[model samples]
Target: MKKIPVLFILVLLLAFWGCSQKEKKVSVKKVGPIDPQMVQDQDDMTWEDYKPIPEISWADPSIKPKRGFKMALVAVDFPDQPFVITQPKGSDLFGNPQIDPIKREDVAQFYRDFFIKPSDVNHGQTINGYWMEQSRGEFGITEVDAYGPYQLPKNLWEYGLNEWGQNDFTPDGSKPKGRMERDVDSLWRAEYGDLRKNYDAILRIYASYDETGVWQEFGEMKFNSKEDIPPEWGNPNPDKPRWVATRYVPWTSWKAGAMQWGISSIRQGENSGTITHELGHYAFRIGDNNNNPYVEPYRRAGSGPWDMMDRGCFNGPGGPHKRWVVPAIAGASMPAGLMVRNRMKNDFLTEDDILRLSRDSLAVTGLAVANITARAVEPFEGEYAGVIVELDGEEPHDRTPVDDPAENPLSPGIPNYDYYSLEVVQRIGYDSYCPDNGVLLAKNRDKESRNGGVNQFNCFNWVIDAHPEDINMVDYDKPNGEKVMRTIADYRQLNDALFHAGLNSGSEFEYDDPYNRLHFYIIDLHRNQEGILSYTIGVKSLDGSGAAKRDFQLTAPKTTKESVALFTLKNKDKKAGLDASCFDNDIYRLAVSTEGEGLKAEILNELAVVSSGEEISIPVYFSEEDGEKSDVRITLTAVSESDPSKKMEASYVIP
Candidate 1:
C-alpha cells in the first residue's frame, strides 16, 4: 500500500483509542431521576386548594357502529361425530350432573331454547337478562338465527375441535392450520353465508364436549390404547369411561376478519355471565382484567376481584370454580359490572355523573362532595359529574421518599410515582356478593414503568387496601403460598375498608404519595339508606398544612365519675373538609392532653363528626395515680398543623 499521510496515520490511531473509551462509559450511564418540575409542591397545599378534574374519558372508537348491536347464533356439529349430550343427574345439594345423551336435533334445539326463551335451562333465566343489564339495555341479541348442528366434512379434531383429554392427537400435516382458525372458517362457511350482514356480532356455539370444564371422570373410559383396554370395557360400543361433560373452549378470541365471535363449544348448562365476558372482549374490545396467577415472581392479582374486567365477576360465596355447576345454583355469580373507569370509557356513564378534582384545582381552599352512583348500572343524568378527586403532585405518587434501588429488585422505573383516585364501590345487582361495600381509595400510574428492567405494577392501578394483610381479611393462600392479595377476599378488611366513620372509626388509611410531597387521609366514610357511599378524603402537603385545618372545641367533662374524664370534641373548623360537603363526617384524635400516663382515653361513640353541630364524646379513664376524685386541669387538643400543638384546645376540670 502507498504510504499514508501523517495526519491520516494520527487519525487512525486516535479512532482506535476512542472506541476503547466508549466501551468504558457504557457502564456508568444511568436513567436520570424524575423531573423536579413534574413534582407538586407539598409545602402549602390543602384540601381547599384541590379542585376536582374529570376522571372518566369516553373511548373514541374509530369504527363506531350504529345505535343498536345485533348478533347471529350458529350452532355447529361434526359429521357422524359421537357428540355426548348430557342431562341433569340425581338431584343433590350441588344440583345435577350431565349423564344422558340426546340427538343432534336435540342439541340444536337446546341452543335455540337457550337464546329464544327464558327457562330453567339457564338458572331459570336467559342470557337476555345479563346482556341487557350489562349493556344497560342498549345492546341485546334481538335476532338470533340458529344454523348448524350443520355437519362439517372434517372429524372433530380436523375441524380444530376436540373433547377434553382428546387434544393429544396430532394432524397428518396434510393441511397445516391453526386449530381454532380452521374451526371458525369451517363454521362460517357452513352457516354464515348470507346472514353475516344482519348482525353487529356473531356467536358460534357447539354442543356437548367441554374443553376447559371441570368435570369428574366416572371411570367409564379407559386411559390405555384400544388394544390395552380394560376388561370392564368389553362392550366398546359407546367406549367405556365415557367423557364427562366440561368446557370445550380453551380460549376466547375475536375473529375480526370474519367478524365472528366463536366458542370452541358450549356445554349443556352455561350461564349468561360467561357469554357476557366473551362479549366484553368482542363488542367492547376491552382486555381481560384478571391477573395471571400462573406467571412467575410477582404473581400479584391483576385488577383482583373488584372489576367485572377482573375475577370479581366470578364473585359468589363459592368463588369461581363453583360457577361450573349447570343450571347455576349460585344465582348470578358474575361480577356486579364494570368498574367506574370502564363505564366512563364505554359511555355508560355521562360527564354529569362524575366529579373531577385535579391538582391544579387544589390550590385554593374548598370542600367537594359527590354522591356517586354504582358504576355497574347506567348512571343517572348527573351521577358521574362529581366522583373524581385528583391530587397530582410535582412528583409521582410512588417515587417520593425514594426506595433504594438495591432493595426494589423490581424497581418500578420511577420511585413512589402515583396519582390518587377515590371512588365509591357499592353492592348492587352483580356486586351484591362483594365482600363489603365502601369507598375505594386507589393510586394509579396510567403509564408503564420499568425498574431493574422488569415491568412492575404493570396494570398501574393499585387499590389501596385499608388492611393489606390481616388473616381475618383474606386468609387463603395459593398453592405456592402466595396470598390472594385483594380486598374482596377478606371479610373484615373489606368491611373495615368502608369510610364508615364513628369515634372508633377503625384504622385510618394513610397513603404517602410524592414522597414528602403530598398525603391522602381517608378521614371518614358514610353510606346512605339508598346505598350510596360517600368518603371524606383529605389531601395535605408533606409539610402538614392544608386549607382545611382541624378546628374543634373540647367542653369540660360531663361528670368526673368512675375515674373517667369526658370531654366533647366538636368540628368547629371554619375551613371544613371533604366530609362537610355532602355525606360529611368528622374524625378527631386527642392531639395533646395533660391527662398523660395517669389516665386512659376511650372514644365511646365510634369517631365521627357526623354534622357540623355534632359533638363527639371522648372519655379519659383515670389511672390509680390520679385517683377517682382529684381536682385536676386537663387541656384537650385537636390537629391543626404538622405538630398537633398547632391545633385548638380546651381545659376541663374533673371534680
Candidate 2:
C-alpha cells in the first residue's frame, strides 16, 4: 500500500515538473539595430534589408601645413641652483646621480635621438610618427637652449598659491590650478623672451625634485601644509619614488604667452612621452583625448588605449607607471598612432578613404560585404573607407552637460539634430592598449559645444559604451572596497564610456534613435590573422515611406505540451499592400522539424504571405501511441525570399 502511494507521489511530482517547464524564458532572435517604425503584429513582422553604403563625399577641412615647424627646447632651472640629473635607486632617501651635471646640448641631443631615430622594434618607425605623417616629411623641429638656467621670481608653489586664498587650499574650495602656467610664463619672459621668435613653439624642461624638498617648498608657501599640495605631488613612496613634476599640457593662449609648451617633468636621467601628447594640442589644434584625471569617479576611462588622442600615448610593454624606472626603454615604448576620427578631422584622410552608405540605400539593395584593414596602418586603397552607415532620422536636442560647474552657462543649441557616426577599433600599432577588438559605434552630434565643467574643446565628441558599470577597464586608481567620496582619488576616474558591437555571432547590438525614426545594428564582428578587425553593420530607415520591407521573428515556446507544439509568427511591415496572399516573390516559407519519436510536424501556413498587421500560428503534433514518457524537440524556421541567408528561428520541447 505504501509503495502504491509512493508511485502516486512520483507521478504527481512529474506532473508538476512538466507544468513548471512551460514558464521558461523564451528565446528571441538577437539582431542588430532595429527600425522603430516596425511593430509586432498577430501573424507577421516587417523587416528591412541593410547593406554597406558605397561612399560618402566627406568634406572635412584641409589640414593646415605644419612644415618648417621649429620647436625650441629650453632647459630652465631656479636661480643659483644648477639643474642636476638625479637618478633614484630603490627606497633611497636621496637621489643618486647617473651621470655628471649635463648642459643644455645634452638635453637637445637626447630629444633629437628620441624623435628622429627609427625604432628597430616598431618596423623602423620613428617616435614622431603622428607629426611626420601629418607634415609629409616637410616639417622641421629645432631644439635650442634658453641660455643659462632661468630663475623663477618666487618659489615654485608660491607664485601659484598666492592666487588662491588660504581657504581655497581646502578640499571644497576652488582649486586654482592653472596659476602654475603664469609662473611658467613669468620665468620664461625674464630669461628666454629675447629669443622667443627663434622657434615656432617653446618646450620648457625641468628636473625632478626630492619629496622632502617639494614638501618643504610647499610648507614655505602661505598654504597650510603638505596637505594643500596637489595629490599629484604626493610621493609614491616615503623613501625616493623620485619627484617628477606633473606634465602640463601645451596651451597656445597661456597666461605666460602664446605658443608655450610644457612637458611633464621627468626623473633627472629619464626622457619624456608627454612631449608627443602636448604636441598634439599645439601643432594640430586638437584637444586632449584623455579624460580629466582630477575629476570624480576616478576610474572612468577617456579613450582607453585606442587613439593617440587618448590613453594610447601611455602604451608600452608594462604600462604608464612602469616608465618611472631608470635605464628605462619604457618612456617611449608604444608611441601612439591616430584614429580614423582624428585622421578625418586633420584632413589626413580624404573622402576617397571612406565608404559612406545610407540606411535607405541598404533596404533597396539586398546584401553587401566589406574587407576592412586596421585603421592604424596605411590604408590599402579601398580596404574600407572609414565606414559611415547612416540612419536617416532626427531627435530632440538638449545639450546641457550632465556635470558643469562653471559660473557662466552656454545654451545647448538645436531644436532637433540629425546625423551620427560609427567606427571600427582594432589592436594594432599604438592601439595595442585598447581593451578589445570590435566595432566602436558612437553618436557624433554635427554641432560643437564646449565640455561644460571640463572646459575642453572636444567635449562634444561622445562615445557610447557597452560596460558603463565596470570601472576597471579605463581607470588607474582602484577604490579597494571603500565608500566613494569626492576625494582626489575618487574624482579622477571620470571617463567617456564607448559602446562596442557584440563580441561574437550569438550577440548583436541594436540601437534605436531617441526619436524612433531609425535603427543601427552591428550585425556581426570578425578578426583576421593579420590582427585586423572587420564589422558587419546594418542601418534601417523608419521614415513613413521608402521601400516595403519584411522582418521575421520566432516566438519560442515556453513549456512542454502533450504532443503538439504551437508557435507565433508576427509581421511588422507598414506597407498597405501586405496581406495573406502576397507571396509571389516576398513569401515567407516555414520549415518545422522534431527530434523525438511519434512527433509529426505540421505547418498551418507553409508558404504564408504575412501582411503588415497579420499573425499566423504553427503547430507540430505527436502521436499518443508514441508514449507519454518520450520528450520531443521541435524547431521552426522562417526564410524570406528577399535574402535566403536572412532568417529567424524558434525551438521548443514537448514531454
Candidate 3:
C-alpha cells in the first residue's frame, strides 16, 4: 500500500488528532560563533586545474537497491570546495579561466536532466519531492531561489553566524563585485556570510530532516569564477582559496546547469555533493546539519558519525565529505536527536566525537522527525532534569527531553536563526527522550501561553512543540510586585513520584482544637494561609482567629520534611498569611498532578490570589523559558485536601 504525501507540514499541525506539548527548561546561555576552521569547505576544482572534482560513490544502494534514489551533482567548474587546503601560493594562476559563452543554455540543460532522469516527481516515492523538496538532497545545481537567504558565494566560501557590514566585504574595493569578511567571529561569518566573487554562482546546501522537526546540513557546494571575484575576495594575506568552489557558477542565471546534470564538459568541475545534497533532501526531507547558522541544507547529529545524517557540525570528518549513512527510520534505529548517548558510552566514541556527532545527529533528528528533537546545548548542570510525565494517557519515564518539535519543524524555508533555542539547549546540557545523542525529539506544542500571564513554567518559544510524555504545566509569575513565603521545588523527581495524595474519606472527619471542641473538618487550609480547601458540605461557616475557623482561612508555615532541606523563601514576610475573605465561599479542595506548581481562584470582583497571594498560597508561577526544552521549577501553590499554600510547591520537570 502507498501512503500519500500530505498537502503541507504546517497544515497537518493545525489538525493533529491529538496534540500534546512537552517542554524543556532551557536557560538562555549565549555562545560565540564557531571558528572558520570548524566549518567545512568543498572545492570541486577541475582535473584541468588541480585534479577535477572527485566522484562521490552512493551507488552500492541499500535495501531496495537500484530502485533507491539516484542523484549526481556536477559542478560547472569546481568553485567552492568543502575541504581543507593551504593558502594559495603565488602561482598567479590566471587565464580567462574557462568561461562558457552560452552559460544560460548550459544551466538550462542541467535542470532538464535533473527533472528528467528519475523524473524528479518522486521516481516512485513521495511526490513534489522531499519536504520533500526543501533541500531535496539531490546533488544538482542550486542558487538563491532554493537557498533563499542562506546562500553563500562560491568565491566567499567560509560559513558561521553571518551578517557583515558592506564594509567587511571589500573595504579595499579591490574586488568590486563583492568580498567575504575575514575578521568576523565564526558565528557572524555564518549568519551573514556574503558573496565573494562577481561571476555566476550556485550553492548546494546538504540537508537531512528526521521524524523530529530539525533540518540538518552536512555539506554544501558554492561555485563561481575566481576571476570574477576581485583580488580582495581572495584575501591580501591569502590562505588557501577563501572560496575553494569558485569554479564557474556565475552570479548570473545561465545554462551552466546542463553541465551540473553531467551533460556539459564546462561543468565537470561542479561539486558532486552539491547535487547529491539536494537529492538527499528530495529523497528524505533531510536537512543540512552543518551547524553553520548561515548555510543551508544544514545537517546536525547528536551522536554517532556513521550515517549521512551525522554529516556536518562537530562531526567534521577531518575535511569536507558526507559519505556515511544509516536508515533514517530503521525498526531498531534510534531517534536522530539522541544517537549520541550510545556513542558516548561506546569505547570508540570520545567526548569530542560525541560533541560533533551528537550535534549532527540531533540536528538531523530535530529537522526530520515529527515526534522527537535534540538540542545542542552548552554544558550546564542541575538546571536540567530528565523525566517523563503521563500526558494523553502515556506513562511516565525517567528520560530527559526529546527534541522540541514545536519550534523545530525541520522543513526548509524556516531560517536557522530561529534555531537559537538549539544553542541554548546545547549550553545547558544535552539529553534525549530517545537518546539519539543526549537530546530528545519532541512533540506537543505549547501554544496557549502567548496571550500572556504569570506563567513561570510555560515555554516562551512560539514555534517549538514539546513531547506528550513529559507533562510540563502552564506557569506565570506573581504580579503584585512582592515576595511572599520562600518556596522550594523538586522538578527532577516527577517521574518517580506517585502523586497519590487526596482526601481520605468523605466530608466529616473528627477534629479537636486546643479548646477541646470536637468539630467537623469542613475545610482544609494550606500552611501559608494562601487558600482554603473547603469540603462539599451544606452551606455553614463561622469564622474566628487562629485555629477557630474551618471554612474561611488562616496562617501557617513550613511544608517540607524531605531528607534534603527543600526550600526557604529568601524573602519571607510574617505578614504574608492568607486573607480568608478572598477565596470562594463554596468549593472543595483541588486535586492536581505532583507536577502541579501553583493556583489561584478569585470571587466576584475581589481577588485573594492577586499578583502575590497571601503567604498561604505562596507564588505558584514563574518565568517561561525562551528556548524550547528545559527544567520547570513548578511550586505547588494551592489548597490541597490536607494543606493550603503554606508555600507547598512540587517541582515539575517539563518541556
Cα lDDT listed for each candidate: 0.42, 0.41, 0.21
Which one wins on TM-score?
1
Backbone clashes for every candidate come to 73, 35, 216
Compute each candidate's TM-score over C-alphas: 0.62, 0.54, 0.22
Model 3 regions lying over 4 Å from their true place: 1-72, 78-316, 319-655
- Candidate with best lDDT: 1
lDDT of the structure predicted as candidate 2: 0.41
Write the candidate numbers in order of decreasing lDDT.
1, 2, 3
Tens-place lDDT digits, model 2, residues 1-655: 0111111233344345546656542211122221111111111111111111113101111322345456555444444223444322332222323333445446544434444454432223333444544333333343333333445453333322232132122222333345344455566567546556666666655433322122212221212322343433333233422222222211101111111122333112233454566666676666654554433323233344555665566555444443332223342345445655666676667676666655445444422234344465444433563555544422233322344334322212222223345666554444444444455554444434444343343443344454443343332222233332322221112122333342222223555654534555554444443434555454444442234565666687675343345576776654534221212123355687777764555543344334455665554433433344366577888875444565888888765
**How far out, in Å, is residue 545 in model 2?**
8.8
Q: Using alpha carbons, what is the TM-score of model 1?
A: 0.62
Model 3 lDDT per residue over 505-536, tens place? 21112222121111112221111121111111
By TM-score, how accurate is candidate 2? 0.54
